[model samples]
Target: MRVTRRRPEWRVTAIARDTYALEQKSPYAQCVDYLLVGRDRAAVIDTGLASRGALRSVVTALTDRPVDVWLTHGHADHIGHAGEFGAAYLHEADRPVQAAHSDPAFLKRLLREEMGAALAAVARPVVRRVTAIPPADYRWFGDDQVFDLGGREVTVVPVPGHTPGSVCYLDQATGGLFTGDSCCDWGVLLHLEFCLPPAVYLESARRLLGLQRAGAFRFNWPGHHGFPAAADLPEQYAACAESIADGSGVVRPRRHHAVVRYRDVLITLPRTYLAQPVGRR
Candidate 1:
């Protein structure tokens, strides 16, 4: 069978009234950023990895209101174009990762490791563009910070597991919860050096579940390819993590490491980390 790939480009889709999903596809990664316009100012979530300042043009065409950049986490793919915008805001816990990624050397090292030599060679220009525009300054914010954009309010919910500072933005006006890589349809990655253990991640998932039960938000917009995840995704993710925490899930090898799969969610971790007694919820 022949394989086909989606051409990488910058496209915008209106997800809701006054809200748009700016999707950027590349050979390296597919990133879905968001733009929320309010009565006064507008907010951009998770600027996609676009070199040449294409994202700025997209946002400008969407709304002329003052814009603020808010990061879901410090991942390179998410914050690559953040420098084009003014000061960006992120959780303090992720500052280290964000700072490290801002360095050209560190990003190059990461590309070499994650993409390997052949792929990295092809992805070098994209990587350079990603790191070219480093944010002038990153404003640190904590959990539960409410950003009021005139009539719309977005509450920051800390969902630390994908990354120490990973968070979901709950839009009070639209009932949309923007979850970066914290939870997704493809799979939630928990194997990186900066990622938390499955047990700890379960807590964050449970918290989201609590919000879901309380009618806090209606839908989820994941960071990557999948958008508007099913409402029960948090519950399902929590259950998967629970099994992993208790050593009940079957382990399978993937890319030289073991992972526990639960439905659409995959929990990847080092064997030693999985054997640790901590974070057994």
Candidate 2:
């Protein structure tokens, strides 16, 4: 169901007027990248794994316009194939995270801890292929930075929590917020060493909820696992982060980590972090 004879590597869906969803298929890794096409040029949200083949060709296949890559965050899965591109932008805060996650051995071991050892071993080849290092000299952009793709424009909303530089891109034309690895239906990962405090994520969640309520964007386009996230997903996560911040959230074990789950949404964090006061943390 993931593929057909015509397209083997990706499943393309026109999620918005000029926006397309390029999803990697075959094993269905669920890594989704968004391509926004404009009259003069194009903007790609993230480059997916190299195992799917050259991402530049994929974007060109959709639009022949000149393209610039914008990263939602610097995590390994989201920043895939950045080195192959001519121009890629990332937040300065996640510079360390980008360097650390670029190592294949480190990523392999971390994958083993996150996904079982057997699965990690199975995915080793793809992981190795995906360890394409992003450019060290990146054009850094902070919150409120806008990338103008001719008629289309994407504004960066700094929602740093999953990573210090994590962000969501808002497409002004379509009201589609491309949430790259921030809080999603699956989870928000603040348990990692490089992640910011849970309180930071809580504030971000509240802000995103406010934006949604204020009709800043109609829906959330998640980075992984699913396509369009539920309308209330941000609200649910805001509640979850609030509970975790106030020390009222429930914690349970998952494989090798602990998470505060709200229905299907998960916020992974450590006990030490959970114990700290919101302000101190």
Best by lDDT: 1
Cα-based lDDT for every prediction? 0.82, 0.79
TM-score on alpha carbons, each prediction:
0.91, 0.90
The TM-score between candidate 2 and the true structure equals: 0.90
After superposing all C-alphas onto the true structure, candidate 2 shows an RMSD in angstroms of 3.2
How displaced is residue 137 in candidate 2, in Å?
Answer: 6.7
Tens-digit lDDT track of model 1 for 62-115: 999988898999988888778777678899999888877777778778677656
Model 1, total clashes = 0
Off by over 4 Å in 1: 1-8, 274-281
